[model samples]
Target: MPILEDLKEYAERATGLHRPGKRQAAELPHPRKPHVVRFRDDGLVPNHPRWPLTLYRSAVRIDERHDPAAVLEDLFEANGWGDSWRNGIYDYVHYHSRIHEVLGIARGKGRVRFGGNKGRIFTLKAGDVAILPAGTGHQCLSEEDDFLVVGAYPPVGTYDECTEVEDRPKALQRIPKVPVPRKDPVYGADGPLLRLWKKSK
Candidate 1:
């Protein structure tokens, strides 16, 4: 059987058995923290204190049988992440207060700005992933015509849009309280996110 099909079967059986297990992807070397861009509070955006925004490049192997977004959704769900969605980033700036978010670039390329107006920007392509801690601001700067992204949140908290000054206080409060996810979205328990985030905290 093909690998993707085998994964699907394994997932179905695991679900039926009510056991927590994940089918492994092609293992890439663990990403180092220096590759990540950490955004801080820039007044307008109250970035998380305990968590930092992290990005992984060329993290997954891409091929014809797999849609990057679909693969990411499965990877995240296997790692105890939920609330997955398939879409592009919003044109305007926004942040989530109550939950951390992960974005996997499924196709094309795009430039995105993180950490409010003062934050740095990133150019991303297919197979790349970004993990945004709570209260980190992000905006879509530009993208290729075929651009697409998949997003999801950890299982701990509900998601809330925080786009105004009135939302700041509540957002600030919630950012630190959001617990680290049990497993890294793309690499399950052993992924870079677990090492980086746990060390930072």
Candidate 2:
């Protein structure tokens, strides 16, 4: 409920930014792991075992005429994903063992670190999107003043934050139970997620 309120506030605050605008549809096979990346962990990110992290560079190609945030929301919603929210990434490290998360860089730019304290950092800008498997750690390393991000999760279960060491075992149990999302957050049914994730399974 509180998250819903946050989402509402974010939407209202950006109302003028979502007006209809022309832009090209996202082109896929754009880039996958290594350059974009797939972070792995043993039991560090307990629930994140089977799925690899995914990042798409310049996935949407932003411009003054289009709203990257609005387009990302529509894509996730159409695919039955919910719990959408808009904001910058948290400055401190955190992860959710309950659900996979997708973050679209809607405005400005920022640097994010993934996979705990030893994780690498990547710079992101508008039109970039990151799909984090459940339990993977992420934190904002730096950002521009205008940085804004749109994030959403699959429409199956509620999410819980796990920043403490004691939460590991229970989080591990919960993560595997989370069903693989039926649609890719950005590319719908035929997206790269299925192929990439299926290989891991």
Candidate 3:
């Protein structure tokens, strides 16, 4: 029998996972202000104090002609975010204590709850993007069957998912130290991320 990791890989491959179009089509995003929201550490979540979560609505153009995932993968790669993956959101509340994350919606729609229990819920659709600072809690509230998301991260941080109650202490210690990304995952060197985050600091 194959190892568990091999089995998972086989399943993903059989189901057509991580495959995007060969065409590279990412360009400038539509001009729009990133909607920013900050979350307080709710004991369990350890949300970032200085950087707020940023949301970009219809930031990129994803249409029927181009593979949506391909579009985002190119967009993110061009903006200096790498290690891209295509998938759906996790239903349970979870967060990354070490790395910041960027999620670009490729297909369908979903309602996602951000922050801890006191966090807000936002409906996301295709062409949308959400940038999560380190230690920010997020969960999938509801989603369409065809909902697909393209996720990537900045070059600076490591990726570690923290969910259980026991992950708090270290999360608190490490969350603040996650270095700010040099570029926005959506817009690039001149994007609003640099302005907003630096202004907050």
Candidate 4:
């Protein structure tokens, strides 16, 4: 709860807003990467212009100390958004090839399920951390009154990086209007990078 309060205070001081649902444009400093963290006041609002129903995202970065799992919990608890839950049920599905994510839980309790098959679902509490391997399907099932989430993406960005590049037909053509599911989950798979870590193992 202290984390949530701190984030709220930071958001208010940064944007002059008391709630997390409102959108406020602010510049965040990242010594390790070039990125921006946009704060929102409305919970139901979407982070992108195309996806209005998609969950709102606050303070995204590539910091090593701030994991995605921990940040997510904090965001949920601070905004009173409830706990994390399994993917493909009530949570958003990446549906794309493969991507890595780090989540932070600030408040409440929830669980995360990774991969379509042979995946693991982790129960997360306040200050808990979860990592989703690339090409793995992930979702969060909320169990608490509210939950806060802070997510981190790789330097290339989640999904395809080509979409952001101008005048790149290859990237644009390869980009899908909707994300596609991976043939297999990245965790426990035989690969040097895939073997990096496991939520359960």
Candidate 5:
């Protein structure tokens, strides 16, 4: 519960613009909550610093982009350190205002749910992929054994230039109500970062 509280506080502080527009007093829903699977007992890594709540290193990165297929192949490939991708969760929550994400469920069953919306869960199994549009809040629900998720993003420096508009009017103006789909998709060959990860022998 402390972790959830902490996440809530962090989100509130990070956003700066609270419900009443006052500093040091803000409330925001915890973006995503994934039950701590491992890393709680001893630690995520051996002898790591132990705090009241454990924090696992996030494998996913805002800067890294790869192919869904190739990334999946590499995970199971012998030379690719098969066990490296065995099981893990990325603790880091990424917020990309300019880019969308393509998530591919490669080898197991899991759930993806966007924040602020209940009953919008998408359950995925092997070979199933979901495309999450930009600014749509989301988080992983559960990761079954050997669950593998591959994400794709735009080119290097593309997201870096992204601007986060906090002002309500500005943010509203930036986002179009018409919802025209982008020419280049976010998470697959349909995405901008195409073939970044290729199947290897």
Candidate 6:
């Protein structure tokens, strides 16, 4: 029955039947300050040297009465992070060198390792969001069956996945050049993300 509902919901979304902007939309409550964590380049991972990964716990309100992934999509798009996808995190270790990403946990929970082999595992639950700077490594160590995340990128860069050690040499060169996001996916221009990233430079 749940899968059936999910199928129907997906169909409606694809057909542009479910999204109501400004009205009938799920409200996104302002979240607390994010917890910032930095990582060193583990050689293979090529973690960002300046910008740190940002984590927002219970950052959004996941309403069960409505499709939660849509809530994230709407919010991210509004904040200049567009072209979102609904899916689970990749199980294998990987990092993005061409662009930064924001992950909104729409449903369920997962233990995600950030910063490659040297990273820490954090349990992310519904309504949580993680803002990954370019070159930061991330992987899903474990997850709930219903785990779903809404991932989006800023307009500034392309989305490229780096999964192999062979990708390192090029990644190290490309990572530093990846443009930092101009807006925070959750809080727009006034968010702490812009401030932190600016201060890092």
Best by TM-score: 6
Candidate 1, position 195, lDDT: 80
Q: What's the candidate order when arranged by decreasing TM-score? A: 6, 3, 1, 2, 5, 4
Per-prediction TM-score to the true structure, in the order listed: 0.83, 0.82, 0.87, 0.38, 0.39, 0.90
Question: Which residue ranges in model 2 land beyond 4 Å of their true spot?
Answer: 1-17, 20-36, 42-44
Each prediction's number of clashing residue pairs: 0, 0, 0, 53, 1, 0
Q: State, as a TM-score between 0 and 1, how close model 2 is to the true structure.
A: 0.82
* lDDT of each residue in 67-110, candidate 5, tens digit only: 23343323222111121122222422223344334454545577
lDDT of 3: 0.84
- What does candidate 3 score in Cα RMSD to the true structure? 4.6
Report, for every candidate in turn, its global Cα lDDT versus the true structure.
0.76, 0.73, 0.84, 0.34, 0.32, 0.85
Where in model 3 is the C-alpha error above 4 Å?
1-24
lDDT of 4 at 193: 22
- Tens digit per residue, CA lDDT, model 3, 1-201: 124334543454465454232234446468778999999888788889899999999988766665677678777877789888878899999999999999999889999999988899999999999999899999999999888888999998899999988999888899889988998887788999989888888
Q: Rank the candidates by lDDT, best first.
A: 6, 3, 1, 2, 4, 5
Better of 4 and 5 by lDDT: 4
Q: Which lDDT tens digits does candidate 4 get at residues 1-201?
A: 446555655654466443323121111211121121221212221121111111112223323444333334333333322323322223643322223344555455677654322334566555443433333345565456666544443333345221112323332233222232121111112312222222112
Residue 62, candidate 6: how far off, in angstroms?
1.4
Which candidate comes out best when scored by lDDT? 6
Candidate 3 to truth, TM:
0.87
Q: Residue-wise lDDT of candidate 2 within 16-126, one digit each (tens)?
A: 455332123333224443233556653555537777778888776565664566666665666667677878899988889888899988788999988877777889898
Model 4 TM-score is 0.38
lDDT of model 6 at position 51? 93
Please identify which of the two predictions, 3 or 5, would achieve the higher TM-score against the true structure.
Answer: 3
